[model samples]
Target: MIIEPRSVAIIGASNDQDSVGYALVKNTMSARCDVFLVNPNHEEIEGKKCYPSVKDIPYEVEAAIIAVPAKVVPDVLKECGEKKVKYVYIISAGFAEAGNVDLQDKLVSIANRYGVKIVGPNCLGLMRPGYVNATFAPYEPKSGGIGFISQSGALVDAMVDMAKESYGFSAIVSVGNSAMLDITDFIEVLDQDEKTKVIAIYMESIKDGREFINVVKKAKKPVVVLKSGKSERGAKTALTHTGKLATDYSVYRGAFRQAGAIEVNTFTELFSVSVLMELVGEVDDMVVVTNAGGGAVLASDYAEKYGVDLIDLRKETIRRLDKVLPEHYSRQNPLDIIGDATSERYWKALDILMKEKYVKSAFVIVTPQLMTDVDNIAMVVAKIKQKYKKPIVCSFIGGSRVKNAIHYL
Candidate 1:
């Protein structure tokens, strides 16, 4: 189901400026995909003959991206139903989230009867950068690593934007309102997919808690989750919108841990875990190294919350570090080297840390004023491949001057 599409029909196809239809057509064409434009009144849109309806299209489409108004969705879906399309991306809005539980029931009902898997009635849709794209959020990343699933449109767009600037993604999925098919369905499908090595998700709620928990844990692949909507205000908003969650924060947190998934608090942290997953694979323990003691201490404190052991280097290892690391540096779990360390010193420490027995993974922090030669440090990090079979994540916290030099070169 990843990329075996013979053709796709874009419902609500139009040539109007700034139309989602126009953007979708452009994006689809860019991928050189066989496309059919579906619209009742248009003769042609973007040089592609506009079929009056999905039924009129000669070829069978495996997927249909419906961009028409929500009111007309059922009719459009009805047309797709007759054609027996397997996958439908309902990009229109104003469904269950509009406070119509009855309508929501009807939507789910139709999908179940027809054997159609729906992404959303109010979603941006999924983007397969490697092949098929169901979204119109404007992303053309150098596709390679971590796949993304999110609920919010703005956030989904942000993820695409951030990926282009900071990292590469295998795919990006937008889960809005969860009318029928939700994140778990997508996760189940992607877990078996060969192209996707890692999965990062932004979950506000789960539709199938037990199934979802079971699927993710059994995936045996690196999965990073950033669960939001925990506060009273957030809970009220989410509950009012999605009908609420019976399980509380602690319950969800425990579920993530038992499933062997790393649960991060923020979106940036989620992306951080995702980016590092490309380098580090399935870490059971971590070593924290930072130039600032306070920052290192705080990081170690949070590391304990996930049951990830902060393995301190042994006395033998400390003796080796003492031979190389400066006098003021602490050789323990949160290895704190004072402010005077340079990129050379950081590289040496990294070289030594890679040799340490207990450290399965490590996080390096270098603040703005920590040092110069940021390019040199980036080179060192890029050079240190997964030769030792451990994941290494580096965070560049340097000042504005060396910001570009800090992250990957």
Candidate 2:
């Protein structure tokens, strides 16, 4: 109900333009559902009548976004329960993360008595593009295939801005403090969402380790995890941030492997792997065709490190490539066609590699040289990508020279 509510009430609505309450009201005004504002201090905000409480609303509210003070959360949640609201998202802070365990416990107790699911006591709320923007994020993300659940709300804000042009999201959730519902709950829900092709998670700690592994193992879609708190100091910092102690990094890594989840070290790898998985599903036999030998070598090293199989070229495949590529071109899996190669060489080399029945996907690397036609090569790559309907991750290596080509791809 919280992810896509039919009707929602914004508790603690305010007129102060800089306040979180005001931001919540403003962001949610564009949602496709009914939105009601509540504030005891104001009669109306932006010409809309402000109810004193959830009890004052005339109709049923499927979800309530609470942005009130920490001390008032219990009362506000109780009122939501009396009004039969199924979901409540506590956007306010100063809960367990602030060492206020008693206050957090009180809110949780009230929620269970009313059979309500709480999203957070310290979080940024949720967002479903083109449906609802239930967050204070400065920029709303464009709708696409990735469903991202993060412990750090600020990181979600950053990702929204960075991915605006490169990729998009099906939904964005910030699981703050995890007083009631955790990352596992969101993962289970998003796994069944047809629009979400892949699930990406930025986890600080796990509330229930056994349950997390079970959920990921049974997930039909791919699960990519970016875990933090690897160092002792980092784990302590995570505890202060989310009120949950992160276990040893090795333990979490082993668990992820056992559950068949892909674990990435950096944010760049997280989405790169996700986009690849979304487009190609899984590839057992892969190859790299690059104009730079060094780039191919680096790719080979990483492929070995990450367990990606870069299959060797067969004799027949090499013979076919020999006709198109220069005689001196490297004939192995990372088929380096020499740095000075032009777009035609790239087109022919990629065409031959993609046609091999044994080859499933490819990585095409292009380095800017004096003779390289960066823009034309990008067009050729785009054409080949459409023709084969196979995954082709491109690395247009260089600054201004390759910028246009990168954008075209």
Candidate 3:
């Protein structure tokens, strides 16, 4: 499986600080696996002895990362096959996407002959949290419930850095070119991983649509997809990017919904929805708690636009809120606590809202007002969030003044 490897060999390991090969070798220094550097030209890289080839290494290698020039990838794969490596990650480019489709096929054929699973031919490598930092990305993500599979290696880098607080990953695979093991294969692998409670993907196109739908439909956890290539021009761009023909956007959209995957339009929505899904399973009935009336109104309108159900508070619940809130406050779904709200006020409101049977989760939107204690409110929200086993997302919608509040959450 891509999530765990006993040992790894950097087939094109190098010492040049500016090259991709250098980054690959440098990033693996912290990998928990046994890492071997391989290069016929170098005696050693980063103080690790460089093996002449995979076959030359004395120990068995589970994963071999091909980082040499595209022309040398076939020979490298041959060495990996002879060495009996189970998994391979090809970081070299100039394959199918670069008008070298035959060369890409040859690489795939070698892997199939050896019964090896390939992650990529022209993409960033995969990273298993606490196991290996195989990708060229500089940071290693903290282990979490989301398993992210991406077509764009650059997007993977951005997402890994973007993750914080509750949003992190169990594993990340950049299925570039997907010469042998495509998105479907990786999805099937993650679907069975117990650590992964949620699956997120960034895709330009699907390699096998039918298999993809079948696998996703049977997934036990939530699947979140951020698909590109909607417009004619964008589809053409995707072709140039991944060397795969982009299907009609409508077909992909419908298929994703049919397979029970939540298709998102932007990167932000993809991660936001994924975080909420992992944190609060199958929760749709949400309460919007805000200090500003306009913020509440806007949230309510967007909730309807996005097909999110706003739980109508029970009469008894409203009465309880009425006792806790000011006289002018509206005791509705968007429980506006007025502009001069304090942390305790927010605490009492959230405390009551969370108790309602219909309220599964909440969105705490705080528009910074002159009298609003932003930090205190954030503290209260954080405290209340801990007591409940539900999702609570905070939107401290402001500039420099709200930085501390965001940090607290």
Candidate 4:
């Protein structure tokens, strides 16, 4: 079953509080996961007595979490197989990445024999807020709505922070090394999850490439991806370690298009797209409002590249804009208010466009100069947003002020 498993086991359990295993245990337990510890060396960890092996554990293991050394992983899985553990998560590093191809092959072989499902051979592990205990860092995420799958362990933690601080998520997991389990597996699983409204993924490659395309194509919810290894070196690292073929980025791009998934460039894009996925009713139409012509021009360029139409203002809309904006600034798709625009102009333009049938989304570009008061503009925009239900995105380009605002908003 690709859904969340109720029971779980932790292999390579440790006594060191500072260790990744310790953190994994702490976070998952915080989420109220039905956790069972298996560490022969320790009598108990964090008040829970440890089992010596998966075989020694009393309950049936639904999922197995491994956090021990890389070399000992096969033996652990062997024990898991003996105990009939269905799912195995390996957080130890040292295989193809350590230039040990044979080791990676052996692990894969062992897993396939017993029909073992693996998450990572060298990684921080999975964390699904909706599922049981996570194997990420010490901090577990509070269950919410969105589901996330990341490739890097560190990035997974970073995204966890963003998920909690920004738009909340349902779960988080890392598909490190992707020996047996992979991005597709999680995507296919989240595909059916009721809690998963939005999916933000950090992936380098997909194992079953064709099936990956099919899953996203069939997915009703939006999938936001920040794919790394766009370059040759990056593609190499993504492929060699995960046992996945890092094909041309163009192929993946085309696949995403065919699958109807939105590809993002940065974490900001990932979150913004997902947030917009909920806030906006339709994505094809957008209105670009800016006081700076250059800023409007750049926004138009971005819109053109994405195939998103930026609509021109209606005649009445132009008349309204002309009452407030400078005479030189034309009433066009960008609706540039020019440099001399007052606070009233900003709010007025927003109100007029918010009512427009063609404008499903709004992009506000602000480049404040000597005459422009950033706070004054933000206040006007925020007020206008409060008035309108349509989703509005603010781009404070060309300054740290906007970057600061971007993060805050």
Candidate 5:
């Protein structure tokens, strides 16, 4: 109901331009649903009628967003329950994370009594592009394939800004504190969503380990997790951040491997792996097509370290490449097509490599050599990718010179 609400009520909508309440109202005003603003002190805001509470709205609200103070949350939640609102997203802070466990417990008790599901007590709500912007985030991400669920709202904000011109998202959720609904619940929901091809998570801790494993094991789509709090100092910080203890990293890693979820170390890897999985479902045999031998060596080292199989080129595959590539080019996996290669060389080499039935994907690496046409090579790679419908991760390795080519790809 939260993701595709037919009608929504903003419980603490404000007219003050600087308040979170005001931001919620402004961001949600464009949602494709009936929006009702509620505030006891205001009769009208921006020429629209403001109700005193959810009960006064005179319409059934599928979901309600609570942005009031922590002490005031219980009463507002009870009002939502009375109004039969099933989903409530609390954007207010000062709960368990603030050492106010009793206050958080009170909200949970009221919600359970009313049979309501809650998203957060200290969080940046959620966003479903073109449907609803139930968040105070400054940017609404472009609609795409990844469903991002994170414990850190600020990280989601940062990712939104960084991914503005790059890949987009199917949904973005911030499950802060996880008082009632945890990361597993959101993961299950996104796994069933047809629009979501990949599920990316930024997790600090899990409420239920056994249930999490079960859910991930049963998930139909790919799950990519970027866990934090691995160090002793980081664990204490994470505990204070979400009111949950960060467990041993080894235990989590083993569980993730058992459940077939991809565990990434950094933020960039989290989305990068997710995007790759979204583009090409599951691939094992990969080949590297590069213009720089040094780049190919680095790729080979990483592939071996990560246990990724860089398939050995067959005699026939090498024979086919020999006709197109220069005689000086390395005639093996990570087919280095020499540093002084042009777009035509890239086109020919990639065309031959992608046609090989044994190759599942190609990693095209290009260093900005004196003769390298980065932009044209990027176009050739895109064309070959489209023609074969195969996954190709291009690494145009350079700054300034490769920026436009990277953007074009």
Candidate 6:
């Protein structure tokens, strides 16, 4: 079931200052759901009375977070079964990845018998904005339309810290070991979710190749994947990390393409594409407008590299630019307005370009110059964005001077 729980129970709620149990409870304090603490060692934790087990809590919980030791995870799952919790997030480690495959199997079997959906056997848990922040990660992700699933918990931690302000998430999950539920499971659920508009994945290995491909193919929303372990050494490392052999990189790449999903190579590209996919929607083609000649060239190169075609302007479009731009203007696809150009020039050029029937989208590239008003240009771009049906992306290129302008856009 994909329903957000109305109440949650943390099985290993702890009082220790430096423990995952404490982190889970502390982080989830801001959740909208009613939280019940469970730990036999303490009567209370963080001002809430701690119960010995899930069965002992007077109020029934929709979800149970089993954070106890791996050896006792089965017993905790048994108690959760007796209480009839529908969802489980296993935050504890030392299961399959640690060579304790039998224990992990038993844990999944019990949850299955009780009809409980498990998120992880070893993971950092999950975060669903406006509902719960069940992760041990310190920062809470802002609510947005992007849904991210990752195998590496630390990378998720880094993404949460770095992209928290700029990028938002409808849901975020870290799938460790994935004994019961894996990356494809989350993808299937998120694909059907009304809250998610785009899905992003960071996978070291695939759980079920056929199921993963089929789901991605049938998804109505955009799916972006960043698969690690491209090299032989990296594949070996992946096996050691997740206890699952990494699929051949070439086969996975072909599958992603056939599934109509965007496959990115680096973490940087993953976020870049995901943010655009979520906010701007998809564009089959784009045009570039720039004040700096170098920036225009770079944009053109990348546009071609990413298989986005730049539209050729009609003779009438060139005639329109001739009247507004400098006499020496290049008048090409990368419509280069001269260096000392003002916001008014950019506004006029963009207005002309956007009116063309073929220009589906645009990228506004600006470099800091002595006469450049980065902030003013950004303001003009933002306003023009609202006036068009096409998506507009800005590449405000520079260091400290352009930071505010980039943020403004």
- Cα lDDT tens digits, model 1, 1-409, are 7333567888987898598888787777765457788988889887879999999988878888899987788878877888998878888877777776676567677878888878777778657775767577877666767878777766888777776867777777777777877878778777777777788998888877788889887885688999888775776677655554434777778888887778998888898878777656666567777777777977877777655677768888788789888888887878887776677887778778877776678777766563556677667666654456567667776467556765454
True lDDT of residue 184, candidate 3: 84
Identify the runs in model 3 with alpha carbons over 4 angstroms from their true place.
141-145, 158-168, 194-197, 272-282, 301-308, 319-332, 337-348, 370-376, 386-389, 400-403
Candidate 3, lDDT over the whole model: 0.86
Better of 4 and 6 by TM-score: 6
Candidate 2 per-residue C-alpha lDDT over 1-409 given as tens digits, one digit per residue, 9 for 90 to 100: 5688898899988899999888888898889988899999999998888998899999989998899899989999999999999999899999989999899999889999999999988888868888988788988878888989999988988888888877788889998999999999999989989889999999999898889999999999899999999999999999889888898999998888778788899899888888877877756688898989899999999787566789989999999998888889999989999988999999999999998888888988989999999999999999998999887888888899999998887
Where does candidate 1 stray beyond 4 Å?
2-4, 138-142, 239-247, 289-291, 319-331, 337-353, 356-359, 365-390, 400-409
In candidate 3, list every pair of residues with a backbone clash.
none
Task: Score each candidate by Cα lDDT.
Answer: 0.76, 0.89, 0.86, 0.75, 0.89, 0.85
Worst 10 residues of 1 by lDDT: 238-247
**Lowest lDDT block of 10, candidate 3:** 301-310
Error of 3 at 298 (Å): 3.2
User: What's the count of clashing pairs in each model shown?
Assistant: 3, 0, 0, 3, 0, 0
Off by over 4 Å in 5: 272-282, 304-309, 322-331, 340-345, 371-376, 400-404
Model 4 per-residue lDDT tens digits across residues 1-409? 4336667888766768778788767766654446788888888988888988889988887888888887788899888888887877788888766677788778889888988877777766656665665565645566766678887888777766666656766667778777777788788788688887778898888877799988887777778888888889988877666655577899888888777777889988887777666555235568888878888888888776555678766788788777866678757888787877656777878887887776777888878767766666778777777777667778877666566555555
Which residue pairs show collisions in model 4? 127-172, 129-171, 146-170
Q: How much is the lDDT of residue 125 in candidate 3?
A: 87
Better model by TM-score: candidate 3 vs candidate 6: 6
